[model samples]
Target: MTARPPSPRAVAGRILRHPENLTESEQFQLKNVPTHYPELDALIRHVRSFAAMLTGRQGERLPDWLAAVRQEDGPPGLHTLAAGIGRDRDAVIAGLTLPWNSGIVEGHINRLKMLKRQAFGRAGFALLRKRVLLAR
Candidate 1:
């Protein structure tokens, strides 16, 4: 059988309905994407070529907001992260930072999938929907 061509609206709807299928990195790319986009298959390769060369722990923690803390009497606010990379403290000041993570969202999604699987086809659509909606 021949496959049907998906309408642009159908493609957009599928993407909207299953947005979680896209990773954080992929979502970021879509936000600033230039018009007249090239083939999707070549995007990863092209982007990888321009990707940052992160080295060591400091580089590994590219998105991490902080690298170190200061003494109570030593400073005031958020600590210097890039300074820790070079052991430079001339402009060092505070000792606090904000907490941020997408990990919890990923965890909840995994939990939902596990719950759906453990239902084992025993629960009807209504019951499954209720369980998902009413779960604490």
Candidate 2:
């Protein structure tokens, strides 16, 4: 979930409906499949860079300037969530703050991948539905 102070059920609904509604780091890591396409090279690079940062391999850190920005609420820029969590504005600014998507969507994606691989792109709709229902 977004980790804001709302109800867990509501947050879960939001998470499932729009994984895009995420923390700044989550947004960076998520693949906007609809917009990024055909240009596999650029898409791959963006995804890789995002993944590296999320996984803490890139070693880049959030900037101190973000402390001021966090007070604003337009987008989930570093400042937005930082302020939400009452974090020391400077703590994440200097250190590479590692944030992540909640893993709920990732689990669903993984399940879908498994289904696709097992079906080998030949499964009928009814079978797919049955498999998905039974799998649950």
- Local distance difference test, per candidate? 0.42, 0.47
In model 2, which regions exceed 4 Å deviation? Answer: 1-61, 64-100
Q: How high a TM-score does candidate 1 get? A: 0.29
Instruction: List the candidates' TM-scores in order.
Output: 0.29, 0.29
Scored against the true structure, residue 81 in model 1 reaches a CA lDDT of 33
Residue 106 lDDT (model 2): 82
Q: Deviation in angstroms for 93 in model 2?
A: 8.1
* Candidate 2 residue lDDT tens string, 34-76: 2433243333333344444445633343332333344333233
Winner by lDDT: 2
Query: Over the stretch 13-132, how does candidate 1's per-residue lDDT look in tens digits?
Result: 433433466666545544333332434323332223213222122233332323222221212222333336336322222111223446789998988887788787698788778878
